[model samples]
Target chain A: MAIEVRIPTILRTYTDGAKAVEGNGATLDALFADLDARHPGIRARLVDAGELRRFVNVYLNDEDVRFLDGINTALGDNDNVTILPAVAGGSV
Target chain B: MKYDTPLEAVGNTPLVGLPRLSAAIPGNLGSDGHGAGAVRLWAKLEDRNPTGSIKDRPALHMIERAEADGRLTPGCTILEPTSGNTGISLAMAAKLKGYRMVCVMPENTSEERRELLRMWGAEVIPSPAAGGSNTAVRVAKELAAEHPDWVMLYQYGNPDNAGAHYATTGPEILADLPTVTHFVAGLGTTGTLMGVGRYLREKVPGVTIVAAEPRYDDLVYGLRNLDEGFVPELYDASVLSTRFSVGSADAVRGTRDLLQQEGIFAGVSTGAILHAALGVGRKAAKAGERADIVFVVADGGWKYLSTGIYTAATTEDAVEALQGQLWA
Candidate 1:
């Protein structure tokens, strides 16, 4: 399956300013590996060692992967993977 | 009642202790006035403000700073992009000070926020919700371009937000608890964390700063995070000895647990902080160490009561069934 990985605005610098890129995999883990292969250093930014970085979120079709199968969540063709960064602003 | 206002009530909020919760997590240091094992969890209750949120701190500061520098006039409209609190604060403050306030907000904001702003008499412009606050910022920028006389506070990128907490909230916490070992707070806007964290880190070199982030995928109010970007401009992450993130459901459960068990009705983000504090507490207990962790509960739970967070229908069968459906 080919899924579209949406990169956050901050991480675009690592992906040649592209907001999104294509990856091939059947599950979330495979998709991430595919992304890391294409854009080196991307995996380090998204996953830490063998775990998903606490700050990074992988949303498959807008649903949190944790609520699904976590890193093993199966992906279908044309699935959208959104990488959203924390917006920590505002007073209080 | 015609009463004198102290610079429009920019600061000076009450700090209360969470005695019940403090007991559950032992070895936590108590404030100087309290007994040992009776650690104090002081909440900087911003909900008590005139606008019911802490954004009052920055909204007032931003307006006053602009006025002091001769950049704002009575007729000029105050503009900004916000999700909820900032706009509500600016609306009440600007209207009282004789300025027209216009706010650009994501269209998906809660109905309560929109009605509150309308009650305060501020003009609201809705931007696309799918684009999040980014769209609101773009809209604000476009409006400011068309209206040359408008002044936009731009809280997302504004230093004033963090500065407000630094100058006020930070000092207040220090005065209240000079021996605070750890400071925990949610990472939204990074203003509270950045400002308070900087001040505490400087005043108390050993003070540990921890960000209680929602588990990365928890997008209740559209707040999400990526690994590459951290809100650390005013925040020094090196000062933090540890960081803990809690799942949204875990946070919600924590809030409910605190309210029922400890009687502290704080918001979901506060629950995240509490859950993180408990994690820190458990770790300290295992090491047989004493550590005082102070968490900031930004607001009361009144705003989220409608969501039924505190009123979950957790029957025995329901609980078991929900647990049964977990993915292997």
Candidate 2:
């Protein structure tokens, strides 16, 4: 099984316009590293100095990684990862 | 149940149990497992407030605080950026206070919201729909800068926004349900989460505060660089135990479920909050731990009725109707 990472529209340039890409790793950091090997410079936009950027939100399944273990959060091959830009919430 | 004025009834909303929902979800045995105590889901019906939304609390509080501090005086012009509820709330309060109200809102919001604001005597300025409320906030800021006389009670940065919940919402929830184990609410201005989260932390030990945020579709983020993403200044990560982002489809499903199962008709954002509450409750139940979870219903379903979310044949059909609109 491979871990699927869904890319946001703004970050699709790293994946050659593909909406999602598959990679494998035991943890998110390793997964990002593995993804970077194929999709270069994608990790820098998501992470800043070993931490997630303030405006970037990453979710595994439906849960936020920051609440689990940040970059060290464990990843399973079947787990789906979603990356999104944090914008002003539309709860009107 | 009596108030001298409509504004005086902004809070003290009911905290009712969601028994049917709780029983349907498996593994909801409370810690002690005593007659519905095993698992409980409480709804804080902020929809019962004066302006038919929770924003009434913060809007009234911010305006009153400003009036006290000399920032807002009689007949002053008020400016704000809102997706819907906040503008309606401010417009209601502004009209009563003899103040002129102007709101910067995204062009994609519901028609009922615009009518509601106008009905309350507020002027509406439409911001581009690409960035959603973030664009509205930016436009409102520019307008404020141009007109120094206008009092922009910026909800995103205003302390009173959260303070209102701290003083009223938090205490009301605690008083109503002292055993509340989890508090869940939609993440908008972040005022509700920060204010109530802080107060709950101080009063209840080991209480969990969760924020359920909307996952805007690509159209909402259209052509915008990552640098342009907006996070409210009122947001402080430490106040929340965790956050979840719900997509539009799930929000619609949850909204329908709430009305169908519990007969509680609430907005789409309330569904997102309910989704998070149900998730945590399910987790606790699976672990054989008892919990009392409370979620906020930000507003009634009236404003969104025009979106066909209530009468659509399928969730997908309902979702399609709200596509690119600020239904979240």
lDDT leader: 2
Q: Candidate 1 — which residues are off by over 4 angstroms?
A: A1-92, B1-3, B26-40, B215-243, B315-328
When candidate 1 is compared with the true two-chain complex, its DockQ is: 0.14
- What's model 1's lDDT at B139? 80
List the TM values for chain B, per candidate. 0.82, 0.97
Question: Per-residue lDDT of B1-328 in model 2, one digit per residue for the tens?
Answer: 7889988888999998888888877865433333354768999999999889999999999999999999998879999999989999999999988999999999999999999999999999999998888899999999999999999999999999999999999999999889889999999899999999999999999999999989867898776677668888898999999999898988998899999999999999998889889898888888878688999999999999999999999999998988998875
lDDT of 1 by residue, B154-207 (tens): 775577777888899889888987777778876656677777888898898778
Q: Please give the lDDT score at residue B62 for candidate 2.
A: 98
TM-score of each: 0.72, 0.97
Residue pairs with backbone atoms closer than 3 Å in model 1 (clashes): A85-B224, A85-B225, A85-B226, A86-B224, A86-B225, A88-B188, A88-B189, A88-B190, A89-B188, A89-B189
